[model samples]
Target: MKKQELIHLHGLLAQVQNHYEEETGNDVEHDEYASVSVRPTSIHMSKDDHKDAVFALAAGITSELADEATEQVPAAAD
Candidate 1:
């Protein structure tokens, strides 16, 4: 991956992690959204789903970064 892609990926990962932390975060042992028990379940965010969400988040952030980069580029002096 290119440097821009890597930076965008990192930023997206951080944003998703932060959102998750906010959603089910507290001084508790375990939250259902973030549970890890060996048992049959049907309602849970699977690994693949989580990765997909991360990817989506990363894409959005990358677009924003690209926009900002474009705005920052100095125009040629005419």
Candidate 2:
């Protein structure tokens, strides 16, 4: 992946993480997944690993955020 694309994906992941924290009024603790932690800033990886990591992070983040958003919505009953 290109440098700019990596940067953009990193930004999106970070933004989603931050949004989740702000919405729930808590700081996200990313103590696990050391690779993920260093991802946004620097991901010491090969080209394939870099692409895989970014996609994995994006998928995970999107799923978590979607779950949170779903919980916040009100359901209607007939």
Q: For candidate 1, lDDT tens digit of each residue in 1-78?
A: 543444455455655546655764622212332332211122243544444444555554455456556876666988
16-62 in candidate 2: lDDT tens per residue?
87787788875544544345444665655544555655666666666
Q: Return the top candidate by lDDT.
A: 2
Reference-based lDDT, residue 26, model 1: 24
C-alpha-based local distance difference test score of model 2: 0.63
Worst 10 residues of 1 by lDDT: 34-43
Runs of candidate 1 with Cα error greater than 4 angstroms are 1-43, 72-78
Clashes of each: 0, 0
Candidate that scores best on TM-score: 2
